[model samples]
Target: MEEKVGQLAQIAGVPYESEQSEITGPVAEMGIPRKLLPIAGSVLGVSGAETVKRIQDNYLKENRLGIPLIFMVDVIHGFKTIFPIPLAIGASWDTDLAEESARIAAKEAAVSGVHVTFSPMVDLVRDPRWGRVMETTGEDKYLNERFAESFVRGYQNNNDYSDPYAIAACVKHFAGYGAPEGGRDYNTVDMSERQLREHYLSGYKAGIDEGAELVMTSFNTVDGIPATANKWLLDDVLRKEWGFDGVIITDWASLGETIPHGVAANEKEAAQKGIDATVDMEMMTFTYSNHLEELVEEGSVDEEQVDQAVLRILKLKNKLGLFENPYRTASVSDEGSIVFSEENRQKALEVAENSMVLLKNEQNTLPLVPNEEKIALIGPFGTDENLLGAWSWRGEPNTASQVLESMRKVVNEDNLLYSKGSNIEEITTEQLEEAVQTAEKADTIVLALGEHWEMSGEAASRTNIKLPDAQLQLIKRLSELKKPIVTVLFNGRPLDLNGIEEYSDAILEAWFPGTEGGEAVTNILFGKANPSGKLPMSFPENVGQVPIYYNRFNTGRPYESAPNDKYVSKYLDSSNYPKYDFGYGLSYSDFELSPVQLSKNEMTPGDEITASVTVTNKGERAGKEVVQLYIRDLVGEVVRPLKELKGFKKIHLEAGESEEVTFTVTEDMLRYYHPDQTFRSDAGEFEVFINNSSHTSHTETIVLTNK
Candidate 1:
C-alpha cells in the first residue's frame, strides 16, 4: 500500500539525488518523507544521460520492489537541436515537417535518458494576450487536430514504443487550458459543456485517438471545479467518453492547488478528490503521497482506486521497456553523437525556413539583392542569440544562430551596417541616434524587433499584445529615413501590428526561429528561400480588437450584415477585422487560385464529394501555396461558425506551373455537437469556400438530404 502511494508521486530528481538530500531546499519544503524517495514512481525536469542515470541507479538500488523511475521533461518544441515554436510550426501548415521535427526531438531525448515528453500543446487559441498561445497551433480546431496527430505519431512512432528512438507522447493541459479568463495563465475557464465540446475538446480528443500514451490535466478549472479534481472532466469525459485507457497525470503541483480552488478542504481532501476523479499521477506535489494511504485506510478512498492508479503507472513503465533495460538508451558516450547532431540541425533549419510568414511585401520589397542593396540591420534582436523562444529547457541560447553574424556570411561586411536601436524595453537617446545614422548610410534598412524570450511561455500572460514602446520608437525613428524599411519580428504570440505595419514596406514573422533561425531568416531575406508560411493565429489591428479569430459564429447583428448601423456587433473605436487573417500570407512569387468546383450539388449522410481547383504560379519563381477549404452550415440545431476549415493542401508550383488541387469531403467533415449533445451532422444546406485564407469570398452551395 505504501509502494502504491509512492508510485503515484512525481518529484524533482535533482534534490532527491543530491548528497545533502535531507537538507535540500525543495525536498525539505515539501515535507515529503526521506524514505519515500526510493519508491517514488517518476522524476520531473531532470535531463542529460549522466545525471538521469545516476538518479535512476540510486532509486533502484534503494527500492525494495525494483521499479525503475520514469523521467519526464517539458521537451515542448525541441530537445537540444531546437525547432521553431509550436505557433511558428503551425504557420508552415506542413504536417510532414511537423512530424519530422517531433521525430528528431524524440530521438535526442531518448538518448538522454528521457522516457516521456509533455508536448504538442494543441490548445485552440484566439487571444494573443495569452502568453502560452505561442505553444498552441492556432485558433482553429481542424488544424489543431491535424497537428495533434502528427506530433503524437512523431513522438510515439505510431504508438510502437519498441523503437529505440521513440518516446511516449503526453498531450498536455487536457480540457481548455488555453481559454483562461482575460487570457490569464492558470485562471478560471467558465464555459458551457456545449462550448467545451464544440471548440475546445477536439484537439485533445484527436491526440488521444491518435494513440498518445498519456494525458496531462490542465491547471485551470472546467465547469468551476479545478480540472485536477473534476471527475466529470477526467473520468466522465476523458476516460469513459473518449475511451482513453492510458495514464492520466496532473500538471505541476496542480493537485495541491485544489485547496485554494475551494474544491477541497485540505491535502487529504485534495487526494480524495484526485483519486475519485481517476487522476493516475500527481506531478510535483505530495497531496497523493502524503494522504492517499491514509484516505484508503479511513474508507474515504477505496483501495481499488489506489491499485488502479499504481497499475497504470507500472504499465507505462513496462511499455517503455524499463523493466528489461532500466536505462533504455541513456548513454553518456552516445549522447554526444545523437544530440544536436548536424543532421538534426539541418532539419531545424528547414523547419525554420518554412515556418516564417511574409506578412507584407508592398512593391516586392523583399528577396533583397544582397550586393546591390547596402542593408542596415538594426534593433535589439539584430545581434541577439536567444532566438530559441520559451519552454526551451535544455536549448543553449549563447550558442544559437544570430542575425548579424548570419547576414555577414551572405552580404559583404561593408554592405551590411549594424546598430542596436534599443534594448528590449528601454531606449536611450544615444542608441536611437546611432541607429538612425546607421540607417542613413545604408540603401535599405532591415529592422529586427520583438518581445524578449521570457515574455511568451507559461506564467507570461499580458493584457496588451504589442511591440514594446522602445522598439516602436526605434521603428518610428527609422521610418523617417524613407529608405524602404523591412521589419523582421521575433515573437512567440501574434501582436498588435498597428504602429509597425504602417511604416514598414515588408514584414516577416520569424517567430523566434530556433537553432538555425539566423541562417533561415537570411535565406528568405536574400531570395535563397521564398517565404511560404501562413498566419496560424490572427494578428489584431490593436489590443482592443483581440480575441479575434476567423471561425467565429455570426451574431444576429453582425457587422458585415449591418455595416454603418449602430446596433451591430461592431467596435466603436476599432475595426471589426484583424490586421491579418488566419491562413493569410505573402510570397515573392504570385499564385492564382481558381473557383471551387464540386462533384455533386446534394448528398446523403454516407455520400462524399470532391472539391477541385486549379492553382497557377504566374510569377517568375517557384512557391508553395496552402489551398484551404471552408464549409458553413446555413442553419443547424445549434449555432454554427460562419465558416469552419474543412480541409487544406499545401502544393508547390514553379513559374508558369499549374497544379489541380482536390479535397474529398465526406459526412465526417460535417459532424458537430447538437443542442441535445449528440455528436453528428444534420441535414442542411452548406456553403463551401476554397481559397488560400479564411477571409475568403468565393462561395458554392450544397445540400444534405434526410433521405
Candidate 2:
C-alpha cells in the first residue's frame, strides 16, 4: 500500500515517491483534475486499433505492479452506433436493441483501448429540471432496473470484465443524486427513508444486480449528509443491501466539494469523511493527495481504509487482465492502424437517423417533396456547433458539419439560402429581416430552434425551459411566409413547444445530433430516412408544468370531473396535461388501437394476465407505433397515480396491416410503494389503457380479487 500510494498519487512518506512525477498534471479531462487523467498516456477518441496499442505503450509499460492501467471513456448513449440517450432508449422498450447498443458501444470503445465507461447513469431523477435527465433511462424503478441490467450486460458481457474493452460498469452517484433540490445540480437532497428506497435506490440495486463493478459518489447530500461521505449509503445500502464489492469513485473533485457542502473542516477533514464513508478512489485527488497521509499519520483515520481502496482498484485492474498483458497490443506504428471505418460511420448514421423524433406534422407538411428549387435553412444552430447538448467529449463544433451544409447537399447549394436567425439564449431582431428575405427566395423554409447545449447540462439547469423570445418571434414572423415552414429543433431537454407548435407547419426534434447529425437530418428531410425516434420525456406547454410526467401520483382531487365546475386537481390557470407526454411521438403514418383483449378479465396477486390489443396502420405508409400500456390502481391503502406507464411496445407494420401487441400484467408490474415501504400489489379494481400516445388512448377495466 505504501509503495503504490507514493508511486501514483505522490503522497509523501509513502514508499517509491520517486515515481510520483511520472503522473503528470494538466491532465486533459472531461471533469476535474482528480478524475482528469493525463492525456499523454490516453489514446481515447483516437480512431483505430491504434487506440489499443497506445494504451499498452502509455499506461501498461511502467515499472510498477506491472498491471496495465484501465482506460475509461464515456459511452453514454451508443458507442460507435449511437442509440437514443439512455432516457430515449428506455422509451423504446426494446431491451434486445438497448442491450445490443451497449455491447456495441463497449465494442467500439474497447477497440479504442477504453477499459471502462462512466455510463448507465442510474441516478433516478424525478425532476425534469435536472439537465442530466437526458442521460438517464427514466423515472420508473422497474423500467430503470430493466435498462440497468441491459447496460451492464452490454458493457461487461457475462462475468468476464477482462476483455480489453470489456471494462467494468459504474453504478453512479451512489445514492439519491438524482433527487436534487429544485432540480439543480449538486443541490441538497431531502427524502424520507421510504421515499428513498421506493424511488431512488432501485436503479443502483439494478445496476449492482447486473454486476456493476464501480460506484461514483454523488454531488448531493442524502438527507443531512453528503453522499460522498455517507456510510449509510455507501457502506450500508450499497455494500450491505446490494453487496457491491467494486470501488467507489467520487464525482469530479467531490471530496474537495466538502468545503462548499459544509461538512468538513478542511481538505484533511474532507479526506477523513470520505474515507470513512468508504470512498475507494478520490477523484481529482485534491483532498486525498493533499491531506490523506496527514490524516493517516495524525491518527484521524485508519490506514486500513486507504489500503482497502487500493485493494479495490487493484482488483478491478486484475479483473481486466491487465496483470497478464502489460505490453501495448501494438506500437506507435500501429496508432493509425485501422478502425472507425466506413462500416462504423454507416452504423452511426443509422442510429442517428433512427433517433430523429418527428414530434408534429400538421396538415401533412412533412416528407418534404424533393424539388429542383431553392431551400432556406435559418437558426443560430443551423451553422453553429456545440449546442448539440451535454457530455459529448472533445466535441468540435467547427468541424461538425452544419445544418445549412447538409441541406445544401440534399438540394442544390446555389438554391439553398442560409440565415442565423438568432443565438440560442438571446432574443434579437437583427437576423429577422435576413431570414425572411432568405425565406422569400426559397420554396421551403426549415427553421432550427432550441436551447444552446450549455442551457441544459450540469449546472445547466433552467427555471424557464421555453423557446427563446427571439427565435419564437422569428418563427411567428416566418409563419406568415408563403413557403412551407419546417422547424428543426436542437435540444438536450424537452422544451415547452406551444409557441412553435402554433407557428410552425411541422416540427422535428433534432436533438443535438452527434458527428454525423447533419447527414441524419438531411436524409430524414428528403425521405431517404424514416424517423422512428420517440420522446423519452414529456414536453410541457409552459413552465407551470415543470415537474409534470406521465407517472405522477393522484392528489386528493385528481383530473377527473363531470362538469366545468368543482374541486379537483385541475389548475385554475392551466390544464394538468403535458404539452407532449412521455412516449409521445408522431409518424407520417397513422395507427389506430382496437378494443383491448385481455386473456382474462380478472387477476390476483399470484396469477398473471396478458393485456393484448390490435394496432392497425391506418396510414398509407408502413410505420412504427409505440403502443403504450398504462394502469391505474383504482383504490389502494396509500395514494396511487391516476395512471402509470406499466409497459410499452414498438411495433412496425405495413400499410393497412394489424399486429397484436400484448403485455404480461404481472403482480410486479401492478405493485406500488406503500406506506410501510413494501412493494406489494393491492386487490382492487383497475383501469388499463393501451394508447398510441400518452394523452390519447384506448381503455378497459379489470378486477383484482384474492385467489
Candidate 3:
C-alpha cells in the first residue's frame, strides 16, 4: 500500500550529480526522502532522450516493482518547431491546421522521450488582463469546443499511442479557471452553477469526448470549493456524469494548496480530500507521498482508493506501452532528425501565415511594390527573437528568422532602411530621432510594435492592455512623417488600439508568430499569403471595457444609442461595443455574405434544419474566408447569450467566384444546461445568423416545437 501510494505522487527532476546542482529544490522543500524517488510515478520538466534514459536506468536499480517513470512536460503549443499561440490558432478558425500543429508537436516531443503533453488548454477566456489568456482558445464556447477536439485528435492520433510519434493528451485547467475576478491569475472564480455548466464546461467536455487521456484540475476554486479537493467537480461532474475513466492530475503544487485555500488543516487532510475527490495523481507536491499511507492506516482514506489510483497510473503506462519498453520512443539518433525537420518547419510557417489577423487596411496600403517604395522597418521587435510567445518548451528563439531578413528578400537592398525606434517599454530621444530620420527618407513605414515576450503567460497578468507608452510615442513621431504607416503588432493578447489606430494606415495582429513569424508577416506584406485570421477574443476600445464579447446576454434595457438617453445600460463616456468584435478580420480580397435562408421555419424532436447562404469573392484576388454561423435562443426558460457561435467553414475562392455554404442544425445543437441542471433543448423561437463576422446583422428565424 505504501509503494502504491508513492506512485500517485510526482516529483521534479533530480540532476545526475545531486551535489553539483540545485535542481533538487522541489525534492528538499517537500521533504521527500531519496528512497521515494524509485517509486514516484512520474517526473516533471525533464526531456531529451538520453537524459530521460539515464534517469530511468538509475531509478530501475532501486526499484522494488521496477515500474518505469513517465516523463511529462508543458508542451503547450509546440515542443521544438514552435507554432502560433493558442489564441492565434483560435483566430485561424481552422481545425485542420490546429490538429496538424498538435500532430507535429507530438512527433517532435515523442522522439525526445516525452510521454505526456500538458496542452490544448481549452479555457474559454474573456478578460485580456489575465496573462494566461494567450494559452486559451478564447471567449466562445463552441469555438473552444471545436479546437479542443482537434488538439486531442492531433496529440493522440485517433487513440493509437503505440505509434512512436504519439503522446498522451492532457487537457488542462479544468472547470472555470479562466474567469478569475478582476482578470487576475489564480484568483477566486465566483459564478452560478448555471453559468458554470452553460459556458465553462463545454470545452473540457469536448476534449474528453475526443478521448483525451488525462485531465488536470485548475488552481482556482469553483463555487467556493477548491478544484483539487472539490469532489463534486472532479468526481461527480467529471468522472461519473461525463463518464471520464481517464486519470485526473492536480496542477503544480495544487494538492498542498488546499491548506492555503482554508479547506484542509494540514497535509494529511489535503491528501485525504484529494483522494476522495478521485484525483489519481499529485503533481510537484509531497502531500500525497507524505500522508496517503498514514491516512489509509488511520481509516481516514480507503486502502482500495490508493490501489485504484495506482492501478490507473499503471494502466496509463500500459496504454503508452511503457512497461514493455521503458524507452518507448526515446532515440538519440531520431531526436536529431525529427526535431525541427524541414517538413515540420514548413507546417509552422503555414500556421503562422494563416494565424495573422489583418485588423485594418486603409487605401490598400499593403502588398507594397518592391522597387517603387523605400521601406522603413522600425521598432524594438524588428530584429527580436521573442516571437515564440510563451510555453514553447523546446523552441529556440535565436533560430527563428527576423523581419529584416525576410523583407530584404523581396525588397531591393538600397530601398530598405531599419532602426530601433524604441525598447518595448522605454523610449529615448536619440532612438526616436534616428527612427524619424529613417522614416523621413522612406516612402512607407513598417512599424513593428508589441509587449515583450515576458509580458504574457502564467503569472504574467497586466492591469492595462495597450501599446506601451514608449511604442505609442514612437508611432506618434513616425506618423508626423505623413508616410504610409503599416503597423505589425506582435502581441499575446488583444490590445487597445484606440490611440494608434488613427495614425496607422494598416494594422496587422501578427500574434507572436512562432519560428517562421518573420517569413509569415513578410508573406502577407508582399501578397504571397493573404491574411484570413479573425479575432477569437474581442478588442476593447479601453481596458475598462474588458470582459467584453459579442455574445453577451441582453439586459432589461439594452443600449440603443438613442440621443440624449442616459437611462440605458451603457458607459457615460464610452460606448458599450468593442473596438473590434469577435470573428472580425479582413483579407486582401473582399467577401460578401447574402442573407440567410432556412429550409423550414419549424423543427421537432430529432428533426434537422438547414441554413444556407451564398458567399461571393468581391475583389480582384484569391483568398480564404471564414463563414461563421451563430444561433440565438429568442425565448427560453432562462436567459441566454445574444448569439452563440455554432458552426464555421473556411473556404477558398478566386476573384469573381461564389459558393453556397449550408449548415445543418439538429436537436443536439440546441441543447443547453437548464436551470435545474438537466441538459436538454427547450421548444422556443431561435434565430440563425450567417455572417462574415460576429457584427453582421443578417439573420433568419426558426421555431422549435415539442413533439
Candidate 4:
C-alpha cells in the first residue's frame, strides 16, 4: 500500500550538492513525510544530468521494485535558449515556427535529464489583468487549438518519445483556468456549463487529441467544485467523453487545496476525492502520500483505484524508456554540446523576429535608415539584457542580446546616443533631463520600455494594466523633444497603451523577445526584416475595458443592434471596443484584402463550400500577411458570438503581387454544444467574413440545410 500510494504522489527533490541533502524549505512546510522520499513516484522542478542521475541512483538503491523517479519541470517557454512568450508566438500566427520553437526547447530539456515539460499552456485568455495571460496563445478558441496541437507535435516529436532527443509534453491547467473572476489567478470561476464547453475546453481537447502524455488540472473550480476533486470533469468529461487514457496530475499543491476549497474536510477526504475523481497523480503535496495508504487499508478507498494510478505512472516511466536506462538522456559529457547550441540560438532569433507585432506606423515612421540616421535608444530596457521574460529557468540574461549593443552593429556608436530614461518604477530629475538631452541630439528616438520579467508570470495579477508612472513620465518628457519616437514595448500581456501611444509616432509590440530579441527588433527597425506579426489578444483602450475580446456574444440590448439608444449595452465613459482588435497588425508593406467569394450560398451537412479571397500587396516592399476567416451563425438555439475564427493563412507577397487564398468550410467547423448537451451544427443562416482582422463590415451569407 505504501509503494502504491507513493507512486500516486510526486514530491520535490533535493539537489545533489545541497548541504542538508534532503527536501527542505517549502517541502518541510508542507509536512511531507521524510520516509516516503525514496519511494516517491516523481520529482518536481529539479533538473540537470548530474543532479537527476544522483537522485535517481540513490532512490533505486532504497526502493523495493526499483521504480525510477520521473523528473518534471515548468519548462513553459524555453529550456536554455528562450523564445518569446506563448502570446507572442500566437502573434506570429505561424504554426511551423511555433512547432520549431518547441522542438528546440524539447531537445534542450531532454538532454538535461528531464522527462516531462509543463508546456504549451493552451488556456484561452481574454483578460490581460490576469498576469498569466502571457503564458497562453490568445482569446480565440480556434487559434488556441491550432497552437496547442503544434506545440504538442513539436514537444513529443510526433508522439514518438523513443528518440533520445524527444520528451513527453504535459498540457496544463485544464478546464477554464484562464477565465478566473476579475482576472485574478486562483480565484473562484463561475460560468454556465455551455460557456465552459464552448470557449474553454477546445484547447485542452486539441492537445489531448494530439497525444499529449499528461494533463494537469487547474487551480480554480468548475461549477463550484475544484477541478482536482471534480469527478465529472476528470472522469466523465476527460476520461469517458474524451477517452484520455493518459495520466492526469494536479497542479502544484492543488490536491491539498481541496481542503481550503471546502470540498474536503481533511487530508484523508482530499485523498478520497482526488482518487475518486480519477486524478492519477498529486503534485507537490503529501495528501495522497500519507493518507492514501490508510484510506485503502480501512476500505474507505478501493485498492484497485490505487493500483490503476500506479500502473499509469509506471507506464509513463516505461514510455520515457526510464526502465531500460534510468538516465535516458541525462549525461554531463553530452550536455554542453546538446543544450544551448548555436543552431538552437539561431532558431530562437528567427522566432523572435516573427513574434514582434508592428502596432502603429504613422507616415511610415518605422524601418529606420541605418547609418544615415542619428538614433537615441533610451529606457530601462534599452540596455537591459533581461528580455527573456517569465518562466525561463535556465536562460542566462547575461548571454542575452541587448538593444543598445545590436543597434551599434548597424549605426556608428557616435551616431547613436544611449540613456537610462528611468528605472522601471522611479526616475530621478537628472535621468529625465539626460534622456531628453540625448533625444535632442538624435534624429529619431527609439524608446524601449516594458514590465520587469517578474511582473507577469504566476501570482502576478494586476488591476492597472498601463505603463508605470515613471515610464509614462519619461514618455511625456521625451515628447517635448519633438523628435520621431518609435516606441518598442517589451511587455508580456496586451497592455493598456494609455499615455504612450498619444506621444509616439510608431509603436512595436515586442513581448519580451527572448535570447536574440535585441538583434531581431533591430532587424525590423532597420528594414532588414519586415514586421509581419499580428495581435493575438486585443489591446484595451483602458483598464476599465478589460475582459475585452473580439468574439463576444451580442446581448439583447447590444449597442450595435439595440432598439433603444440610451439603454444599450455600452460603457458610459469609455468605448466598448478595444484599442487594437485581435489579428490587428501592420507591416512595412501594405496588403489589401478582397471581398469574400463563396462557392455556393447553400450547403448540406456532408457538403463543403469554398470561401476565397484575393490578397494584394499594394506597397513598395515585400511582406507577409495573415489572412483570417471568421464565421457567424445568424441565428442559433443559443446566442452565438458575433464572429468566430474558422481558419487563417499566412502568405508572403512581393510588391504588386497577389495570391488567391481559399478555405474549405465544412459542417464540423460550425458544430457547437447545444442546450441539450448534443454537439451538432444547427440548420441556419451563416455569415462568412474573410479579412485581416476580426472587425470587418464585408461578409457573404450562406445557408445550412438538413438536406
Q: Which candidate is the best by TM-score?
A: 1
Per-residue accuracy of model 3 over 407-526 as CA lDDT, tens digit each: 999988899999999999999999999999999999999999998988999998999898889999999988887899999999899898966899999999999899999999999998
Candidate 3 TM-score versus the reference: 0.98
Which RMSD does model 4 reach against the true structure? 1.4
RMSD of each: 1.0, 4.4, 1.5, 1.4
Q: Give the range of the ten consecutive residues with the poorest summed lDDT in model 2.
A: 9-18
Better of 2 and 4 by TM-score: 4
TM-scores for the candidates: 0.99, 0.88, 0.98, 0.98
lDDT of each: 0.91, 0.70, 0.90, 0.90
Name the lDDT value of residue 139 in candidate 1.
95
Instruction: Give the per-residue lDDT digits (tens) of candidate 2, residues 411-441.
Output: 7667777888777766566678888888888
Better of 1 and 3 by lDDT: 1
Q: Which ten residues in a row have the lowest lDDT in candidate 1?
A: 14-23
| Candidate 1 residue spans exceeding 4 A from truth | none
Model 4 spans > 4 angstroms off:
15-27, 561-564
For candidate 1, lDDT tens digit of each residue in 1-707?
Answer: 99999999888775656862465576788666675788889899888898888888878888998999999998988999999999999999999999999999999999999999998798888888899998999999999999999999999999887798899999988889999989999888998899999989999999999999899999999989999899999999998988998999999899999999898899999999999999999987788888888888889999999999999999999999999998898988879998999999999999999999999999999999988979999999989988999888899998788999999999998899999999999999999999999999999999999999999999999987888999999999889888999999999999998789999999999998999999999999999999999998888898887789999888888898868899999988999899999999989889998888999989899899888889999999999999999999989888899999999999999999999999888888888998888889989899999999998987888888879
Better of 2 and 4 by lDDT: 4
**Model 4, residue 661: displacement in angstroms?**
0.4
Residue-by-residue lDDT tens digits, candidate 4, 478-540: 898788999999999999998999999999999988999999989999999899998999999
294 in model 2: Cα distance from truth in Å? 5.7
What's the true lDDT of residue 222 in model 2? 85
